[model samples]
Target: MDDATRIELEAATFRRLVAHLRERTDVQNIDLMNLAGFCRNCLSKWYRAAAEERGLGLDDATAREIIYGMPYAEWKDRYQREASAEQQAAFVEAIRKPDA
Candidate 1:
């Protein structure tokens, strides 16, 4: 496929992933970090960085809102829960090992 087609497909996939994450409110960021070593926050940071690369000024809060489909504080108040001991331990271990 051409570059434009590839870019379009990737953008569509990203949108779908963000939509899925928004729908799955029960899935906490810590859980995602423990499992995949990245979460919505990471995505937001990446989005912000990309915006900067293109001469845009996308702040953390705005990038997070884009990824969360709502304000970060509101999402946390509504859906975030305290991580369990096991979850915390897993996160630590996951971080110690490099991503595959």
Candidate 2:
């Protein structure tokens, strides 16, 4: 595929992933960090970084809203749960993985 097509496809895939995450609110961030090593917050940071790369001054709040479909605080209030001890431990272990 040409570079433009590849970029378009990747952007589409990213949009779908964001939509999926917005739909799956029951999936807690801690659980995602434990299982997949990243969550919506990570994705937002990535989006923000990408925008910055293009000389676009996107703030954290806007980036998070784009990912969460709401303000980050609102999403936390609505969908986030307190992580269980096991989830916390798993997250710690996952983040500590060598060369990850």
- Highest-lDDT candidate: 1
Clashes of each: 0, 0
Off by over 4 Å in 2: none
Evaluate all candidate structures by whole-model CA lDDT and list the values in order: 0.96, 0.92
Residue-wise lDDT of candidate 2 within 1-94, one digit each (tens)?
Answer: 9999999999999999999999999999898877887899999999999999999999999999999999999999998888888988888888
User: How much is the lDDT of residue 71 in candidate 1?
Assistant: 98
lDDT of 1 by residue, 53-83 (tens): 9999999999999999999999999999999
Clashing residue pairs for model 2: none
lDDT of 1: 0.96
lDDT for model 2, please: 0.92
